[model samples]
Target: MKYNEIKNYLNGKFVSGMGEKYDVYAPINGEIIGEFKAATKAQLDEVVAKAKAAQESWAGLTAKSRSKVIYKYRELLMKYREELSVVNCEENGKSMEEAYAGVDKAIELTEFACSIPQLISGKTQDVSKGVNCKEERRPLGVVASITPFNFPVMVPHWTVPNAIALGNAIILKPSELTPISAMKMAELWEEAGLPEGIFNVVNGGKEIVEGICDNKDIVAVSFVGSTPVAEIVHKRGSANSKRVLALGGAKNHIVVMPDANKDAGSRDIISSAFGMSGQRCMAVSVMIGVGSIDEVYGEVVAKAKNMVPGVDLPPVISEAAIKKIEDYLDYAQENGAEIVVDGRKVKTDEGYFIGPSIIDWGNSKKMSSEEIFGPVLEIRSANTIAEAAAIQNESPYGNAAAIFTQNGRFVDEAIREFQAGMLGVNIGVPVPREPFSFGGIKDSKFGYGDITGVSSIDFWTNLIKITTKWNPEHKVDWMS
Candidate 1:
């Protein structure tokens, strides 16, 4: 009953997590903030049953009625933005500004979900004389979302609001490390008068994730995590014929052409590469210099060198994350690559902190290939645009790639040639806003469709085609 006691939410009330208890930490100080019992496998059936019961009435409501509830949720999200930001910062190691950005993104997605009444409508057409055909998108029943720790609030909101707004009941299984934001949002939903069982949150680790994937009643799943787990989720979820859209890790690349605005390129690469401490899937970890782009590279290094932890960068997620990044930096050292910034020396006594580190291209496989998932940026130089594009293509991840150039022809060429699902010309972080959609290609994402925006409509719903004839066709035709 105490605040910060993490629990599963069902029927508009806090249902205590009944599985193995896991300690939640405040990443900044590595302090035990709370504990959550992982939802047991035994709880899956009951959870699905509740979701089913709530979804029936929910689906029966007109789209307008659903929009009203979504509007209320959006209002509450905005009202509690500061409170949510605090929790997000405590658990996820994001700076207050970054935490606020996460909450704002969640609110933006909720606003997008509120427009479902208009965006989710079906199409009608006349196929034959005296016959009319139409298609309607129906809810996929009880569904689930497995979000990562990187963007706790925004990622959960990614699938939950959109799926539920379209009439499905959704179960949110947030990462155990950062369940506070989701649990807090669950409370907000209750206050917003969302019907019991319509929105649920099951807090836990991998077991609960497997429980979600294996639960027969859960017809669809949306997951955001590393590549290996994303592939597993997609495969396991698909084996059961479940609809799945799993977003995975990325080693995103940003190209800085010689003609690019030096100041803008410096600012953007630093923001994109080091923002959120480089944990996000859209974070650009690799920067490719096309031709003699030394000015921008030097400027980026100059700007990054002075970045103090807790101001310019959030604390690293955990000691484990710090070690992983350290190991990769060691790889650069072994390969004799110049460490331009040396993030290892930047430290704080109270928390896991790594300052922005820039390394000139190591020419090592792991340096160019693996996703370090920390604030380590690698600078690669290419002789031409084709070489730059090739460098990006060499990576297996096709999540996102950006090019900073003012020339329209180069921008157009980059768009066509870049081997990525999401491409940006001048923008560093190419995360598509609401209505535009966000996703990547190849190992970066699995299954079909983007995770948000209009593309998500298909992932969370089922389409039905209806045909009726008032009278028999006068003549036989292929349509008839």
Candidate 2:
């Protein structure tokens, strides 16, 4: 089941592609499971052409009809959920449970897109005389999605299904690390009667990514990656006047109040800090606590230390990532960051594992003010809740910030004062509902929201408004 041999989809058939090849490995065990063909520029161009050709008919379909295909695709995905989950786990190295959850989330997004037909319905407006007007969502010709590796299935599920349901032909460039699941899902979409090239998967690294972003045939580009990469893609794509939605990294924080229950805060912090091995963009990287709650905050540190890291929870995606985590931890310690918990020392069965890391954080020049994408949490002490909130607002990344408190007044104040894109009350991770938009302020996100909400549909399609006005007596030449 090598990735290259698996199939490169274009024009509806699984074709043996001619391109540079790379082997895909399971991050947990470091075993080569398959190979993937890096798409040649020629191949990408062909994909873009096919997508354009197919989009004409696909975009012409009524939103209701487009929604039906998405519905069928959702049904197919649901039926094969287990199989898809297994593939996701084996390749992405996430725990079996988390892998299954990711698949379900993708399914959930598909269902959300199913409801877009009504959500995207145009609004009518009245003009003077015998006039009626409306504005409707129109597909953006051909759109390209460049997804990340963290939640391989889930990320694409957020973009692809919605884009297709909105009547756009899609050319997807899934992460090279976990490309198999995406390719297989495209197969399932084909089974659901998607037209050839209506949904295409091209595998590659920067070449393919840049090609998709720069191609004029791709009317829009949607990206989910690091802030630097997102910035670059946004710049290049926008220079060409393509609609670009580039979501970047996040540095999330959780603030604990003196009056809050330490037990509850500990539990939430543990889950939010280490879930998916802290590979998520919304993972809590910093913890700020009022001085009065220092003892309670120590409990948070103790809990983070106790979390078991291994093949059971999925290792960081690659050896390179593990190394990066190591370098960051070393740098933090050298810069006076207290090593509360060292994940590098954690024991594991067979896979790449780092237990969890916690640092007594300070506002030193060397201590990171940005997001750390690993099982690491930094604890910062503040003299007052106001001081803690001030520190959080001063950080460069404003993706998500949460507060643990029983006081409605405090929660209200924090919500009103927080500078982050997402805010949480008692909740550690502040990811919004599927119907609500997900993005961040500052460096956390670029352009607009990515998935599962109105903003996402807007990202995939353009809105056009029509206004009509006519007086019966002044009406020009009726075709009788």
Candidate 3:
């Protein structure tokens, strides 16, 4: 596909923008790959109107019919999995393997959406004599999905497939940094015979987001990004009387207990911290060494040192991200933290690269608690499991936490007390499969309803109860 061919899709057709176009560069080589036109306000309004018009017909279709279309979409996605991965790698700078994983995850969610017929079934009950009440789930007219640059394909799939399966028309505002992959997805949905305006891709930044949030036609909004931006989306969308599910940032921690296997636990920690260059929301940003600071620190640092930059590792999202990671490393050094393995020294003439970095905070609480969103791991020590749990719980972002302990009792306690939406006992990254809700608590998330699985179906639809009482009227003949 050429650069000019990458335009926004609206109402079942490729629409060229008369507005200003933004240049998109391949992060791998710093080459200009394409340009995307920003959708004007008028264009956005027109698409929303078309989507509102199409949503009624889409909802009118039987669940099985919707499932068939979703299945077809799954087929097309699988067929173009490699192509999509290539586009994702070029745009996002993740390794090919990670890109492939993103594509597979997207396909998995689409497959899950195909089973919406069974998932969306409501309930019935008899409330009183000759009266019965039944709950019905109906589609919200229009939904808008605002996804982040990282995991462009997977994050959008988190909401889009499920929303559409429940018969809601979607206006997708993918991260402007990685819009090509989403454009391809829209094209694939069109090829799968999805109705026009059922899925529209608009390319822009905050302006487009404001349009989606403030638009009365959009009944619901789904967003995944930084906590600050997530709060904005949630507040603005809710203020507009729209249902919002805003998944925010995470400061995930991995607690390595004294009884944990040193070698295996260290390897898992390295993988969790450096995978995708630590751009993932569930990535281990903090390692709480419980009662084994020296032992855990040595092993983790050794493993991290052997991680080769730009080969076993990948670059951060862009030049700006690389600078941000560097700034964080500088802060760590200034705060009396030992820079065990500095990734900023990696040699990359073209791409925005940063290898895995480790910082030993020497049991001090002076380290920054912000979500760095890079391959920088901070090591903190806790005297006991309770102290470690407190450190993990006190963070404002309660997205995910993991404990590497063989002791079943500790595992049980951690499961009970850890303040996170997702918990991993031995697993480093415990992201659930398709049929599960993926979200966090506290400042990590805003609004009700998660992105995927049953929560998605619930978010994209409204519930109503119907009560019926039928009485035979033989005495009505008196009126005749």
By TM-score, the best candidate is: 1
Q: How accurate is candidate 1 locally (lDDT)?
A: 0.87
lDDT (Cα, 0-100) at 17 in candidate 1: 69
lDDT by residue (tens digit), candidate 1, 1-480: 123578888767787867888888877887888887887777766878888988999999988898888999999999999999998998898999999999999999999999988986889988887779999888889999999999999998889889989999999988988888888989898988899999988887788888888888899999999999999999999998898999898999998888999888889989998999999889999998878888998899899998988788888889999999898888888887788999999877788888888888634444558899999899887777888888898888999999999899888877788999989988999888889999999899999999999999988888899999875755566666
lDDT of 1 at 462: 85
Please give the CA lDDT of all the candidate structures. 0.87, 0.82, 0.87
RMSD of each: 1.6, 2.8, 3.1
- Model 2 Cα displacement at 355 (Å)? 1.5
Please give the lDDT score for candidate 2: 0.82
* Backbone clash tally (model 3): 0
TM-score of each candidate structure, all chains considered together: 0.97, 0.95, 0.96
Which residue segments of model 3 deviate by more than 4 Å? 293-296, 472-480
Better-scoring candidate (TM-score), 1 or 2: 1
* Per-residue C-alpha lDDT of model 3 across residues 5-112, encoded as one tens digit per residue: 467889988887656678887877778888878898789999999999999999999888998989999999999999999988888988999999999999998889
TM-score of 2: 0.95
Output the worst ten-in-a-row residue range by lDDT, candidate 1: 361-370
